[model samples]
Target: MAATLLFLFVFLSLYGSASCRLLQTPLLDHATTDPIDATQLPTSVEASPAQVQEVANVSRRELGYYTTSCETGNPIDDCWRCNANWESNRKKLAECAIGFGRDAVGGRDGEYYIVTDASDDDPVSPKPGTLRHAVIQSEPLWIIFDSDMNIVLKEELLMNSYKTIDGRGHEVHISHGPCITVQFVSNIIIHGIHVHDCKPAGNAMVRSSPTHYGYRTISDGDGISLFGARDVWVDHVSFARCTDGLFDAIMGSTAITVSNSFFTQHDKVMLLSHSDDYMADKTMQATIAFNHFGEGLVQRMPRCRHGFFEIVNNDYTHWEMYAIGGSADPTINSRGNRYTAPTNPFAKDVTMRMDTPESQWQSWDWHSEGDLFVNGAFFIPSGAGASSNYGKAASIGPKSSSLVGTMTANAGVLMCKAGSPC
Candidate 1:
């Protein structure tokens, strides 16, 4: 009887061990899923082993970095090999083989410059006269225009999926007449271009219009505007001498990134508008980083009308007016921004007068209003009554505040420029 009982116990133990092994296999299988195929993935994936080894490597490449080749006027392809960065490599291939004007405009090679002749039609389609369309119906089209040529359209430059418009640099300037607009485009990138001097043909008061309204007003023109677009990136671009804001994303534009750009000579440099009548579902997120603001001789920094925005690692100098302004709300997260203005008597006022004084020190008011996080390096106004005007740093996290003063500083000679008041 004892021998039979012992046998039964051993058999039960064996069964439990087999069951445990079966459970473990699935977890191990999941952990060992097949490596992503380079060809199947987006062009962002580099086929090199170095990229595979560092998961963060791909993202780091996308954030603005200048290659030595780009500075030396060498072929972008050669430059990519020298830099050992994915962006440089992709840019090189796009320029040399793809012939997308990598050399000219702002491209590293400076080839394939846009011509400003008004008589020239779009290369893809030559209309009888100048090209004018309310909606764009093309993908991966490269539009290059000389500095003098201004492509004015009646409506949005509507791009379909996988479409890219490389400005080549400031060489091409496209101005949308008051009615110019875009809607429902995805996977789009507008880079290395200078956009300005556009006016909406309607009224700012009217929220929406079938024919003419907010964007219709000449006063409402935006440099690079995105509406209802997704997975969009606007990088290494400049908006100078515009009548209105430099960059704006409104009306349900999701997963947007605006990085490594410059804005100046405008009322509001960057604006993310979510007005009352224009109700956007709360899932939209924006990453605005590493941008330089000022020197355009403009006023009012960036106005985020309403949205969840992560503003980080930006430098602002000679912000002729308010460095940052926007609605106070739960969605916006302003972090790691540096603001510098020489004569801000109101610096003390801003710090002391607000109902929530701690929130006032921030470049924007999202934290006090109920944002999840807000804190970073802020340069105190020189004449403020606060004893430590130079470095009264505050942040949600000590690590974030640690970055203050290291990168933040008063505008230097290069940024201030001649004839501009420092």
Candidate 2:
């Protein structure tokens, strides 16, 4: 009986060992299926949790995601993204991506490029057969109007897609028609340009309506009109003596940064409007910092909607009407803005007064509606005794008596003279 039991045990052990060996062998293992064709795999399979986790674990440095070197070798080097000489060689990298096994669609750069012209009458328009060839070109571009030449008309310079128009150390005068119009675009940058005297052409008065009246008037000609665009940056530019608003960015456009610019002599210096039928919620984010707003004989107002705006360290002086108008549900964080008036004319301090005295001031005062946010600021009233008489004086009054280190005052001066970090 013992011998028979031993023989049975040995047979069982041999069978178990053979089975384990077969499982261990790569050739015999059924779990090891053939390599997968990535293209053939379903999107769900490709984006499995395990694969996503693996990709997430990859450091940006390892993937060369934000590396300055990576921006180079594309069709257009977005110099704004990185400051490197290799950015100029982006076209080479794009060519390589297409010629090699890399995806063609993935090789595409941004929209726009920089065109250089030193002579007048040099047409910046696209070549024949390409009515708007330059328009469709997927590259962010700029035209450096040299000091030698003058641009007579820059109308219909429709910069669509991710693009920019940079005037490098030159003066561009758009006297006859609309200076520059940005329509149906995103991620744009316009800097260091001088735009002046752009007169509106056709149907200026016919399109008049309560909500859309100002948009089409002859005085509606603007230095820059950002219509249906997002994520725009306007820096170090000057708009002088315009018929309409110097810079007008309206129509649900969000994420705008306007800084280090000088604006003067316009009906409405910087008007941000949100009329009815505009689908965008009033709640957008805007940053207006270190800008000089003043020297206009007419009304200079900045109207906002439901947005959070940072109006900091701006030098505002000499305006006919309200300096800053926040009729929209705006959380205006006003800090360190200097309000100065000329000694002779002697203007009234910045006040939130309604046009109609009979109307409840609180109803018109958007701040009272629980949207305005003020911190660490100053208010120099119009007249000597007017400061004390103004209603809601306690609320609009500065929190801290000292202006030192409280507001972002003279920021432009700091940046220019001391070379401080901005």
Candidate 3:
């Protein structure tokens, strides 16, 4: 059991789509009438006791390791990478996640589905072993690639619940294609897949499930779109240039986490909340930790709204405009982060409050503690720096930024070395 859990740890560490470009704005902008009236949005779902204990099991093992080198590295590296028996025990990664998103078990109780084919040929009757076929099936499944693959989709990949796209033992790139769309689903995990250069796909029939087919309008080519979804986790992904937002959580998506990922050459990186007025997102919560916000990123490491958020231990190495921004009263708990700002003195403030007047936004609950600011970078904190306000933030606040380099040294899609730790 100890070995099994440590394997899950590394894979769960770490962290999109394209260009249905123009249409990818805040949902409130397209409210047609009143999106606020949509009262059916989901709230945060607590993990079952069994699931909670599962994460606790991994946490106990994580106490022993913290090096970037696999030899003496922490459990996150041992969980999968350094284990020479990796290929034979690949699925253990599906079990190793933490934070609220740890509830995303992803294809845990289902049979293995190998995507032997990469073509997105027929959505109505997708070819077996193809990614579209695997995700559309109703049963839970652990999906893996047979070999190195570069798949470009015909339209947005609408995923059903209970699925994990494990890309640990191969080089898989889902690029220059329609990216993934997760809407109103639960328990989905996407790990170690290189998603970039995604384009807009829509205006046609697409399959969301084996038994359902629906028409999709033009989509904004976001690398990944989470709309009203619950219990979803995206880890170890490498995001580069994309047409739209790199990662977005909107329309009441809750209990989500984005960790140990790498982002570069993107504008408007991540967005949380549909809009300033999407009050339903007040319940939104996420743990963004151990990620490296690399070069060419302008702002919005996550421009949040409403929601209570935990932005902890992330390495912000580059930003032109700002790092964390939001409006409409977001409770942001920033801790132990390393922010190295660009030379642009005009854009040194790591926090943005939209256009909210200082009198009103000043009262919002935003606090920064133990952050390392370089090159004149600074976080503009407001409200009372009270610990009582960051409710439901990760029970385990992030480790210090002093460990940020090791924690995220292997960020993005890690190399899947065969017969050895990746």
Best by lDDT: 3
Minimal lDDT window, size 10, model 2: 368-377
**Model 1 lDDT per residue over 1-422, tens place:** 99999998888787765544333322111111122121221211112222111221122222221221122111222223234343323344333211111112122233332334444233224243332211232323333433435666444333444444454422445655532244556655555555666665443333221232333333366666767867666655666655566777778776666655666566567766555346582445665644566554334345554455545445454454455554433134344444443244443111121232445435432421111111121322212322221121111111121122222221111111122211
What TM-score does structure 3 among the candidates reach?
A: 0.82
Give the TM-scores of the predictions, in the order they appear: 0.51, 0.53, 0.82
- Model 1 ranges with Cα > 4 A deviation: 1-135, 140-161, 175-180, 202-219, 296-300, 328-330, 347-422
Clash number for every model? 21, 16, 24
Candidate 1 lDDT at 115 equals 37
- TM-score winner between candidates 2 and 3: 3
| lDDT for each residue of candidate 2 in 239-335, tens digit (9 for 90 to 100) | 6776566777777766666655666677667766455335473645565654656465345446555454545445454566556664433444444
For all candidates in order, the CA lDDT equals 0.40, 0.42, 0.75
Candidate 2 residue runs with Cα over 4 Å from true position: 1-114, 117-136, 142-148, 202-219, 276-281, 342-346, 353-422
